[model samples]
Target: MPPIAILVALADPTRCRLIELLQGGPQPVHVLAAAFRISRPAISRHLRVLKQSGLISEKKFGRENRYALHPGKLAPVQRWLAGLLPAARITEAPAVVIPAVEQPLPKARRIPKPAATPVILVPALAAEAAAPAPAKPAVSQMGFDF
Candidate 1:
């Protein structure tokens, strides 16, 4: 199966761009950050995600960390995509037919539904329902009540 981590890592636009940048050659975090409008920390986070997915490798050169692309990590993804192509599909073998014995299904027991009971309102509630609602105060065009 193709590494799902690679797909997850590539899902982000920042990470995708980071991969593209690394393709040319290994670059330090500050050099990669210079290419983007986002903060250096944000670029570092994207690089971290790519590293976790095994799509890129980090090498320390003195004080600076350079990230390089590992193209072989994408082989599984390529193979998985190749399988989806029309030409990659193999023809299926002929299926053998075997007659199955049929058995009658048992009848399901039916339960009678209960009739709904009528709702009875109390005298106090009925009186309240009969009373007219209070009229709302009239408001001017400015929305202020007199």
Candidate 2:
């Protein structure tokens, strides 16, 4: 499995940026801390996490502690990711085309529809139809009927 510690160490934006800084070559803690707006102690804490993950190494030069990147430690992570992808085939199979055979569709039989009958209205029903309809209730934008 890919090193969970490496993933956890790189989870923080501060730690990721520290890795980027170390990529330039070994640098003293003071120089690395100067690259960020955070406190020196906070930078030291991030470096410690990276060291614990085996992603970086520290060397003492006089009173200063210089950190360097161990990029080879990331191979397990790369291998784990590559394993998730499907393998490519060296040779592809040739395509074969089959000729199409078309057949005529059968004719559909039609049935005649019955004619519509006329409607006659009585005088009382005619008067009611001539009368105006009642006004609908007012509706608000919220769908409430007033």
TM-score for each candidate, following the candidate numbering: 0.58, 0.57
Instruction: Report lDDT per candidate.
Output: 0.81, 0.79
For model 2 the local lDDT of residue 103 reads 53
Taking all chains together, the TM-score of candidate 1 against the true structure is 0.58
- Tell me the lDDT of model 1 at 11: 85
lDDT of 2 by residue, 36-119 (tens): 777998999899999999999999998988999897897776666667654832332333323223455568889888899887
- In candidate 1, how many Å is residue 25 off? 1.1
* Candidate 1 residue spans exceeding 4 A from truth: 86-146
By how many angstroms RMSD does model 1 differ from the true structure?
24.7
lDDT of 1 at 112: 94
Off by over 4 Å in 2: 87-146
Residue 62 Cα positional deviation in candidate 1, in Å, after optimal superposition: 0.7
Itemize residue pairs with steric clashes in candidate 1: none
